[model samples]
Target: MNHRNPILFEVEKTLYPTVYTLWVYPDLLPAFSTWPPVLQKLAGGADLMLPGVAVPPSGLPGVERGALCAVTLLGNRAPVAVGVATMSTEEMLAAGMKGKGFAVLHTYLDHLWEYGDKSYPPTLAPLVPDPAGKESAGHEEEQEGKEPVTSSSPDPVKHVAISDLSLKETDSCAELMGKEELHESRAAEPAEDASPEEQQEAEDTRTPQEQMDALFNQCFFHALKCKVKKSELPLLTSTFLRSHMFSCCPAGQQLDIKKSSYKKFSKFLQCMQQQKILQVKELNKGVESIVEVDWKHPDIKAFAVPEGFSSASAAQDSKSEDREQVYHAPEIIPLYGVSTKMVPLFQESGHRKGSVLSSSEVRNIIINYVKANELVDETNKNFVKVNPILCDCLLDKSEQDEISHLKWDELLSRCLERLQPLHQVTFFGQEPVVRKGNIEPIDITLAQRSSNKKVTIIKNLELYGLDPQCVANILQQKVQASATISPTPGAKDRVQVQIQGNQIHHLAKMLLEEYQLPRKYIQGLEKAPKLGRKK
Candidate 1:
């Protein structure tokens, strides 16, 4: 808790045995320079706006959304506030640096700082970006390599004291500092002095997919080194991806398995296991778990945390970490498309053939059309008089009884039947996938093999966004039976999982209870062996 000029402190929680914010050095986190006014606003509980951020000649540090960051006033290296980034570096540029940027958590004049000697932040002149701004990329790289030493040197930072300056002089000095910082931020790109071949060699030679794969491996190793504990072995792979690896990913980068050469995350883990970095085992059919991590592996020991990627203070707040992690099953919502016969019926509602609408939306349109046409039966109230649109869509050709009316429930059912059935599947943190035709429910069937051995065959899990292999792993582990997944007959792209013995009950329970899927969306539950009437 040494709070002298450099302000050394540690943030911890009684609930957490270990401190969540681990900064071996005070300047480890990325720092953004701002004006004294912005610091005042931040100390008064205002978020740091992008417009208020004073960028140095080197430009803003690369940081991802949720990364911990610090804020300092112009011409001063001493940070006056600490916060998390509200958006990534690229996002700020994309937005033209207008909206909110950093979410301030602590400030110099706040209660936390009050606990110390209440010392005012010492003035240490900020690094002056080269005025000529003609430094080559190689020189810039070299300077960056020396950034750690320069940043730490500011501690007990030797600089002229500003106490003697009058109010007008101080303001003038701040203005000059602001101009220098802006010039540095807008400095021109360095010239390339290398030959074409040399330039090519200097640039990353890997393909986009290869780079992403390497990033995944880097984040995985980093997570194993700094985040995962030996006691947390047998960690669920899905949890590892969503919680640990994602956090370790560097700023301005994303961790999407689909973008990697190894499309499946499981395959990536398997590759790591092959390389002896970690050991992955299927504790259940379709589900893989990391049972062991090679902490002392040469690669792990040699790994270095990438610059500006501080997950410890940046990933999330302490309260967020304390919350329990929960899995969100994919959401499947039914939608309807206007059919040719119903095109005229829904024309007034601006719905054309092939336009999709939710059930409630369709019902509202239908009700509005019916009421406007005064189609509801005057006497019964439950039946609706058939109009030309309804007659065209609801009646069959063979029903020649000259029926002019239908029950309310019957009319709604006929309306839905006449329209095209569609469904949208949405996974967490992903775009919704809209598909034509009815959603195929997960199918489970019991079949007899050549030796009269009963087995369970499951299909169409992909329709609900479930990975077939992962499901197979879970089922295999649950029943302690051999489970295999292969391409479905005549379908090259789709696959089915087959497990030894009739384990339909387990499969149904997983879908119905754990996944919270609607029973109507699950097919062949009747094939499950009856509890009382044993097979």
Candidate 2:
């Protein structure tokens, strides 16, 4: 017997060593610039540590967890090593710049680099300002009056530029302190205290472009930290601008990016990318997408939204969400209402003329009233003696028998019959609504019409405060059937919905699930055909 097999890309073989001819395209992954000694350690198969990595002043490049990244010497843009990030850029900073930073897989001196053409990293210009140079210059000034430190023993933290990690936060704190001091100084000066008009004039002194730029930056950072999420990433730039950033602007203040100094959306994105707020890439030709975001940036964390800004947008979102869900009427139950004639008997039980009670409740109240008044006959336990309230409520004038007593069943029946009909509709999360009228059960009937065709007819929906036309539209959409609404025959100002075929299954789901109507209130459910049975 002969067997046939096939192989995919030859690149898979060298993947374990992280070396291939594919490395020719150096910009394949996000590059993190660090010192040469750190690259040497990685070459020896040691994992990169956060303390050893040199972060530029602009900040670390935005990278997600486990994403492929390149490592380069601080002065050179050429990557000499390849690895996957152990965590996102924000997480690395959150760790206080301590712990493993990258899982190094390939380096210049590793076996993989030897397998390919053995070439050394080229001497290239640094893409960012060297933090070590600035630190050394500052350290010299601090030690001027103190002991003179020799250049032979330099601080390792200063050499590796680890101080850059805290630079952004320190600068932000200084800026805030500066603002506070300025306010205090103004308050201390008697002539500097200004009126509202003066403050307005001072604000108006700023150019329009400067004001627009400040507003643009505020909304951008606000949207990134508050409104946007990692899960919603790879979002289109246009959507981020309009749906998120624009909506976050103050209600009366419009956000026109064109008015800003950057003048173009692409320019703004490029500036943010340089600051490491986010990573924007062109997924498709000429279309930019935000692939990753740095949620823990110091600027984003420090930005506080102005009070009441975007309040209208937030409220509108909640209202729109509520509107999306259909409001289902409550389950309605019939009960007896206390008419003017029946008020006297129920009044002693704390029921007024408009009070409504169920049959059992009314029976219990009447029994209690009889027991409290000692109206039960002494001779027969089954008969209740008539009181003036009972005579006025239960006995009619046409019956002049002047009946002094009545049987227990007769008395209860007369009370219930004489009481006015009422219905109480109870909705979830709301109070029950009681109205004085009869509520007909929603009637659903399945019958054969022309040519033995089946039709489902629904009636009495309006009696429960439901519109037949609305119900018909919902049922038609749900069942994918033809539905028509017409005036109910022999009924005044009432309508009925008629749907093609026996749609009882869909109607049951709509009524029980969507409308939340009780099963007892919907009539003719048994008429629906049983499931999984042939006709």
Candidate 3:
């Protein structure tokens, strides 16, 4: 344990014959030694507020929400308590250091400490006499210029009505849970025919807001102006409206949603959608949520920060400054000189027979065509009955006569065959691109499958721009075998063509002799001489 790192420590132990060291992390909330009474409260499992934390010369460590961090009381660097961060580092900084900080989980005096025979932290700094907790509370109240309301429980959390200066999201969460029940009860009561006292009582209960209508408008605009980000859409309806917008109502005025004319949350959302400000998209079959936002809306434009606030010249000059980290996408090597073939249904549909299409585009066309023609099986869509167009497109004449039913994936393989060989290009890396027209060394490997069945895999043939469907067809004819596409482990972007039988001998011959790829590019050919016979 040292200045920077205090809580983390390692211990060596032996079980039977073997000895090993293990690292242990305990719950200890870091605090300034300046505040011992606060540490005492924390030892009793009290949650920490931002105000109680003393900012040392070194700022708070970068901690994400839900990550466990040690709380080291000032002077002694050893952690006294452990807690989980309530908000992310960026959020805490953006919030100007106000509100709750860590939600304390465990401390030294807790039961967990009883199991360990550990020494207490060494105190080096002079211990100051503890100040009265009430006096500090009074000082805080005076600073905020608001009287503190006491709860019956000793818990630090205080619950106040909407009439309070600030209404937090945590406060409204419980109210929203019981909104429906309250609405139903209100309808059951004969409130309209009530006497003067009852009417006055009702009026008293409903805290009067002179700008109630205007407040809703203000909150709606405010939520959009600040809380809602352009990137967050399509937002979830329940999450966006009820959780976000409802909480944005000005402090001291609760958003009385029942008073609004809209009967339900969805009705209000529908009205927004109808106005074309944003579209509501149902995800996974009618699970409604805010799915889109109208970035170009006039109201949104008005609320948006004006462009060029930081002039282009200033931005250019400050390029070397330590700005926030941004993520840049990994560059992809572009492929050119590719073409695709048309399926039988679209053979004369004007798509060139040997033209090229991306793998995804080809898939979309096939699936959409199947759906539009209603060719999918009524019982199981995966099982497609042999049709003339499919027979011409997917299966060879030999296969057509022998097979009456085929799986959907097999058809996809045939579709992939129509694409012209793709030639890859390098943008900024040292990696060489095998000539777009030339075949690369065939990557061959042996692996065990379920039931201990061993299989041989061959890949890199596709990198030569050769149609995988054509290779599979040739393999089936020459070696009397079948193959399937297997996603390569550790390389998510690449897939290897897998053959059921160990066709290493044939696959190597096909690549070396038939494809005429340079011998230098070929790998594992020395092992290819062994007869890959079935066990």
Candidate 4:
């Protein structure tokens, strides 16, 4: 048996150089000059101090020298021949640490500072030497074997003062660290105001058209539901029926219908049709329901005709009988209650020639009579002539008293005399020649002048041409005067029916009440009746 195996190999590679950040306070700038030449160049320029520091000559009032300046390196790596210190250039030179001497001390400080107080020499004093003084060989050797000076001392007074100074420096460093950290954190946080994404989401939540469509669909569903529940027949017909039903429902009930949700009435009708609950023939039936029959059909009579008498011929006979009975005896009273009579006035001539008064003619006569009465009062002169026979029949006892007070004879004579010339005068037609002792040639041309007779008459009287207004005036007078009338029986059993002023007023009142209309609405009703059967 042959076996095949896969081969694998391990590989290693060098990593890229990492960058580091360094912080330098104003007091620590002089210490950086002590770094090795290569490291000093890597530190960049002197103007670049740490973020929380002010430059030397402008140092913050309470800041001290030899304070710790932050330096961030890659992982645990430290720069060669460099150390962290906080001191100005003037302070470093005064302490006799400059040039080559400062560079050596800086390297030693880096090594010893890492071990903190443990790396300090056992025997040392906290004091600087004068740069001008020369060192003795024996003293220099003795100092070399002793430990370096530290901020703390064994003496109680010196130790207490040094401890207090250390605490004050620590607090100042902490404050500066806190301010830098706070500034960085604030820069990284997001703005407090709303973002574009949030605004867009709010707008996308519900578009205007979507909201409108939802509202419309809800209303449609509610209307369909109401139609389905109340209808007895299939849904197809229910939609039409619902509209009529909704109108009948009170306004409050309509709101309730809107809130209801149910399947569309049309859907219900489709279901019913599928189930054969209603046939196509039934759907095609006319507006009336199946239980009700057409009343206009000849076979249907008397609302509930006998079952056996449902023939068309029998229904026709029933209808004829019904029509005949409609003419009852009370409606057929003889005109003037006369059976028959002979007229003596027409006996001498083949026919009577006196003009018979038409209804309109009678109305005109009554209107003229009222006008004449009004003019008589205003002008203080008699203007109307009343026939004694007709006056006696028309006036009641009280009306006679009112007429007597009106100076009946003089008023009648004046009115008749003034009207005599007008009665004989024909307008735009034949003019009657008045036989007089000496009269100018009859002015036929003048009499036939081209002018609207009605307009001319109205203008002459200074009155409106509207007939209704005139009629209203006459009616109002009759109401106030309370005129009445009576008629005598004649040989023809026909009495002269003179309508009194009060009777005219009663007719006007009836017209107003019965039709809820003014007299102007029936302007043509007061006319002559033809000699024939009533329409």
| Top candidate when judged by TM-score against the true structure | 1
Clash total of candidate 4 = 11
Off by over 4 Å in 4: 1-359, 365-382, 385-387, 398-402, 405-535
lDDT score of model 3?
Answer: 0.46
Q: Which stretches of candidate 1 lie over 4 Å from their true place?
A: 1-326, 532-535
Model 1, 373-477: lDDT tens per residue?
Answer: 999898999989988767777788765358888888888888898899999977655567789988887888888899999989998876665556556766776
Question: Against the true structure, what is every candidate's RMSD?
Answer: 16.2, 23.4, 27.6, 47.9
Q: Which candidate, 2 or 4, has the higher lDDT?
A: 2
Ranking by TM-score: 1, 2, 3, 4
Which candidate wins on lDDT? 1
Alpha-carbon deviation at 92 in model 1, angstroms: 18
Candidates arranged by lDDT, highest first: 1, 2, 3, 4
Listed in order, each prediction's TM-score against the native is 0.47, 0.35, 0.21, 0.12
Please give, for residues 139-249, the per-residue lDDT of candidate 2 as tens digits.
332333112111333432132221122223222322333233322422332222334344334333446776687678768866775566574567657557755676467
